[model samples]
Target: MSSRAPWIVFGSALAGYLAVGITLSLRFGFILGDALSRTAAAQAVLLSRDPHVSAIGFIFTPLTGLAQLPMVAFASWWPAITRWNISGITVSAAFMAGAVVMVHGICRDRGLPGRYRILITVVFAINPMIVFYGANGMSEAGFLFLLCWAVRRLIRWVGTDDVHDLLLAGIALGLAFLARYEGVVPIALAAVLVAVVTACRRGREHWKDMRRRAVLDAVLISGPGTAMFLVWITTSWLITGEALAQLSSSYGNTAILTQSGGASGDLVQTTAFSLGAFIALGPTLLVTFPLAVVLATRRRDLEFVVAPLLFGGVLAFQAGSYITGSTFGFLRFFICAIPLAAVVVVQLFPAAGDLPTRRAGAYRRHRPSCPPMRTAAAVAAAVLCVSALPVTAWAMLQPSLSSQQYALGYLLAGDPSAADSEATTARRVIDSFATERELAAYLDGQALPDGSILVDSVYGFAVLAASEYPRRFVIPSDLDFTQILNDPAAAGVRYLLTVPNEGRGVSDAINRRYPTIYDNGAQLYPLELEVPNTGADQPDWRLYRVPS
Candidate 1:
């Protein structure tokens, strides 16, 4: 393999990602709600006086926002960068490029030929879900990058038994945890695998020495990540005054899981839904995954099998989340498994002829006959390759079938007027936000007294996007809206912008507590004064003046 091959692959993938990021930003304008929220949080971190209070809590981890601070600060100085959220999108794309590079490195480390390495990198870079998220302001890309690096480091550690490698792996996993909560699974899995593998190798030659090393490896792999998780939880508690603020809140995943339906039927339905979504996103994985497992087993290659184990672990975690109803149905959740799947596929065919025959005494004693196993493995690989070829070709042809497309289709499915084209859906999304943009413009024009406006969660992004003084508006999404309304003066709320679609409980309570001063399908009730609407969308926004 040429020394420049990985860099060539990385540079090409980065260029492609940047182009896609720019195009998607211009066309869709950051369509995902989560992306918008993360953008808003990044802005809060950089621009707000009180970031801990102003930024949305629990649902978001802070690393992505913190990472965006430099770009957000730059954008503040140069407003043109804010046009397409170039800063955020660029950061995501860069991380995605890093992920592709990591994939190439992992393949190379596993002794895959340069051609196969390039093929895996190309396949991963062009994956629709990966491309879509890579072009947006989301954490998935960043998390995947960290995850790939961590896995690579662990693989290196296992092969070389270098404590430094294990420590680096732990640090990467810790950072990954900060990027996304699901990172804990990798940390835990790595720790257990290290302990198990080390213990299995123990013998009289160095019994105590091997046991000590095994214990050290386990601790090194898990310690930093676990400590990071606890620190984040502690910080959340101190800031929000809830020890488990990230988990206990009504908006948190734990609450969602608790409220979700419980039954064996729900489990089965969710599992099927998750698998179906995975297939839709990456159909080639279905063949590649099992084929890799068969090949690895035939060769008795412990390191090769780790790829499948890691991929399976991620899938199982997602399946468990779905069954428990802790997560919403989304294709992005399955993304972590994509690179591993690519590794599996690329190695499956090439490794067949490179099978290692050496085995331990225990394994040699119980090993199955070689000829039949080899023949079956060969046949399976052939079948998988043939089946996967058409699917892979189809995937390459339809590189634009992304999670955003699926989400937009689902949203528009109920609207009889929505056209089937991507342009139409993108336009509809922009049009839907027209009210928000207008409301934001109106609020900016008002130049209302500081700490005067209180906003519901639904309009948080709109307010942030459109307002000059976004931090001035109080968001009651994580708090009790009724309490804020009981003494509006005490809370320094002079006006309220109510969007009935969000937080029905809060909307209902506010409507009951105060008389309606403005009702346009979405009602705006005044606690003290009657403030008339000033040319905003009637059905989408209602503005009311609160009596001091």
Candidate 2:
């Protein structure tokens, strides 16, 4: 248990986690999900108006909008996932740095040997989801860091029965929840454990004293967390018109949740995959399960204290989710429990006593030497770290890695090569419509400048057109919607932008009534001709010029 061993293990673990993060980011970089998330962040940045302002208006902006401020500031900074992806990296790194400190704090407090401490650090660094999800720009990494830090604080508080400690725990949990909704699980669990511990004190005087302190701790901890929560809700309402709009508009929508009706399968598969990752990581459930088994017979009291916290966190997370795919792909959601599992594994093996100390205390204070086990464990840990390389490499080549296969693999992987490939393919596919660009150029060159132009393409057409002529263009948010029927553009638009992505319903509604003013693979039609009314699918697109 050399003192320097922890540092060695820390460096090795960090290197491995970063290797996986970089690989996934480059591979999945071009995915639409990454792009959309980047766009959302970019839009947030654009809306910031002033990055240095720090006004309530800055805070009032939606999170998505604020995340994009960096992107909006520098157009050349365009990356598929927004320039703020760097912020995501910062957030993840902050949490991880905190965890490393927390691990050292816990090891010192417990007076564990260097080998045991190194093993615990190894457990944390190699946790699979931690490596994969923490590397992305999402809140999962920060949230996990807070959750782990809070648990460490809770452990210390329990030992000292300190109100300040409890308050710190509360603040961490509150901030974790602010980062992501799923953070409430660990927060609630910690509160419950504190309450139970207070209630279990033996003497009447001790019980009363502990109870009073417990209540005070609860108040101090819960107060700031509650206030922050309310602030989050208020901020959401100011931006989106509702307090829970982000969750309600997307995750809670039943249409998306039960898209195929057999959502049970999705849930089952996700649960299985999550469980599998936990085992594969070798530091989490793999360590905890063995600890639980060994402790049940050898140290039942410690098992009672640890098992419930471990199991409860997992159960609470599972119970809270409403949708199937919500937990399916991203392992980051499960990283919250990794620290607990690592603690359990560390606690499972009794430390080997110093030879002189053992001789001094003899039977009165003897502990097993853990140094021998450290060498074997280090070897095993090295093998596990090496095993991840092939899995990561294989992940890079899969179609899911190259595409936004959110249903199957890590969401934050952000494969840059894959993203670049997709971007190229999207451009090529869009370029096939030579006429769309021609009409767009012609429209840009036109005299009319104050009205909207209708269009049907999803990404390239709408993005390019809108980017080129912001005021005169209007795009459908719905990817599958047909043309503007009653001609909303008729009232104001001087011209139309059409693309092949539009199906029959659009052409049937407007093509017969509008004469072809310009025809190409991308067609431009004048609203001067007459046509019948029928709700049917039609050809790609024809731009029409409405007479003023």
Candidate 3:
């Protein structure tokens, strides 16, 4: 295949992804799921009195929102851009497109045949999770792109022993850390691997020199990335008046773990479950991934081992999150490994007969042509790639459902609407509450004096997006629904909007704590306020007057 062929393929795939993303944004008015919160966060940052002290601090990382700032600013200047989620979707789609290109580059670096590289790149580019997240306004696509680029650079450094490559890898990893907190896993792993390799070289005559170099390498690789994280944390502290404010907040990972009662069992089980979830994302991977690993080990292939090790590091992070009960079941967390695993599976196969031959001794050694094992590997990989198609199609069609649903929804039914009816029902409730214009007008009309509203993070986004006075609202991360209700006036809250059908435990708690406020089941009546019932399956947004 020609050198230009992969670029052409990448371009085509990227165009396709962009088209899908644009279409979804046009149809839905926003990218679904967390994209809503992310968009709102970006808007909040742009509109906040002090961007540092805004609700953006309550979220995971500010990089995604900050990244959207330019586009958000552009949208403010150009009304046409606001019709769809052009900024967020474009950013995400661009990252995903870059990832596809990186996959091709990784394949090319590994000396895989052009056909195999193209095939692997296409498969990864169109994988359900990749397609869905790529087009949405989320951080996963950007994080995945940086991760693939960093891993590729790291592998190149390992092969060529070039310090420049190592530095580049560190830089990429550092940028990735800024993209998402999970990016630290690779940085930590790379540092530890450098130290381990240096220690294992102790028998050499230049052992002391190697040790010194290794220490420097480890520091160089981890230092910048660590610094980026520290700067963010320190800035957050200065802004929020709490060190580690991101993690200590109610929405923080540590708080979530504590709320979940911590990990229930051994770390091994958590790891296994996490790995299982990753495999379940691409079911055929269950067969092909292990076979590829075994074959790669038998062949003593560094590329294969390194790829899986990097992917394993990512899974280990997820497993840690699971074990600590910081997060339970979000498969997009594992999507970064999918492309890497696909590359490994494709590389496991023997190159096609037409491929150009490299110099005999230059690590392009061919196997002894074992038909049985080769055929088995090829068949397993084919099965895995083919198996992903159904889910990929479903996800492309229904990008609104969560990644877990994408992985398992098909088993419930073939038709997406039937398979994920629960999501549809929930969405109906959400749409009813998405009464941005109506709610904003009503709140403005009320003209309550010295009044502010308190809402959960989810509804906080809704309120912020719908209101002109977003700064007046408080989304207290430290308080629960009951706590907030106990002294709403003290918290400067004059009204509370509750969506009972959403099934948030806090919503249920609020209902139980103040049954009189919710006498009409899903409706609340206080200060003679009545929540309009939009329709059946719609969330009953019960607005209540907070007691002074």
Worst 10 residues of 1 by lDDT: 360-369
How do the residues 372-426 of candidate 1 rate in per-residue lDDT, one tens digit apiece?
3344544554344345444533432331423244433333244444455644454
Question: What CA root-mean-square deviation does each model show from the true structure?
Answer: 6.8, 10.0, 6.9
Q: Estimate the lDDT of model 2.
A: 0.46
Candidate 2 lDDT, 140-233, residue by residue in tens:
5555566666766665554555555667778887877765665556666666676656655444556765787566555665666677777877
lDDT of 3 by residue, 12-91 (tens): 76787788788655653333545656766766566532243354554467667677778765544552332245667877
Backbone clashes (count) for model 3? 0
Candidate topping TM-score: 1
Q: Assess each prediction's global lDDT (C-alpha) against the native.
A: 0.62, 0.46, 0.61
Runs of candidate 3 with Cα error greater than 4 angstroms are 1-10, 28-31, 49-55, 77-84, 198-208, 254-276, 290-300, 349-384, 391-433, 436-458, 466-548
Error of 3 at 48 (Å): 3.8
TM-score of each: 0.78, 0.60, 0.74
